[model samples]
Target: MRVLVQRVRSASVTVDGEVVGEIRPATQGLLALVGVTHEDDATKARRMAEKLWQLRILDDERSASDVSAPILVVSQFTLYANTDKGRRPSWNAAAPGPVAEPLVTEFTDALTALGATVQTGVFGADMQVHLVNDGPVTVLLEL
Candidate 1:
């Protein structure tokens, strides 16, 4: 499992012109782009959530856990794009929807269990994500 974490002041995910989830935080929050691959399981998903919540990339080096930040989660299988060969990227490394969707849920569930307010995008849907980045901070966590 991989999570691309970005610190943001506010973020939202829209699907089919309808806003599905959003968070406009007073302080910095996170937009978590999650990807699942073969061999990834619930444990890895949970671990990834823990790491994301504890990551110290927010203002003054404070973690999301320290400030009770909100999180906007989005499924992003393209994170596994393999471009080692030709121009067209290969999705072979990404887990199929059937195998990935539940794990992504596990990740979100884990984050909620950790006491963070969370929002999410529709899985497998064409989404438009909007955000105002904070400090332009971005981090990737793979487990």
Candidate 2:
């Protein structure tokens, strides 16, 4: 599992011109792009969720856990794209949808369990995401 975590002042995800998930950070929050690979499982999902929740990347180095900040989670299989071979990218490293969806849910569920408000984008759907990046702070995590 891999997650790209971005601290944002506000963010939203739209599918087919309908807004699905959105957050306005009263104190700062996260926008997480989640990816899954063949080796990822519920355990990895849970761990990553916990890490993201507790990660101290917000203003004053406060964590989401510390502030009860909201998080927007989106599935991003493209994080696994391999462009080393040629002009075309290969997704061989990404897990198929059936294999990935549950793990993504597990990840979000774990964050919710940790007391963070979580929003999500529709899995496998074409999405447009908009955000005001707070501090332009971004971090990547893999497990």
Q: What is the lDDT of every predicted structure here?
A: 0.95, 0.96
* lDDT of candidate 1 over 55-121, digit per residue (tens): 9999888999999999999999999999999899999999999999999999999999999999999
Superposed on all Cα atoms, the candidates' RMSDs to the truth, in angstroms, are: 0.6, 0.6
Q: Residues 72-141, candidate 2, lDDT per residue (tens digit)?
A: 9999999999999989999999999999999999999999999989999999999999999988999999
* Candidate 2 lDDT score at position 47: 98
Q: Find the 10 residues in a row with the least total lDDT in model 1.
A: 134-143
Per-candidate TM-scores read 0.98, 0.99
Report, for all candidates in order, the number of backbone clashes: 0, 0
- The stretch of ten residues in a row with the least summed lDDT in candidate 2 is 22-31
What TM-score quantifies how close candidate 2 is to the native fold? 0.99
Candidate 2 vs. truth: CA RMSD?
0.6
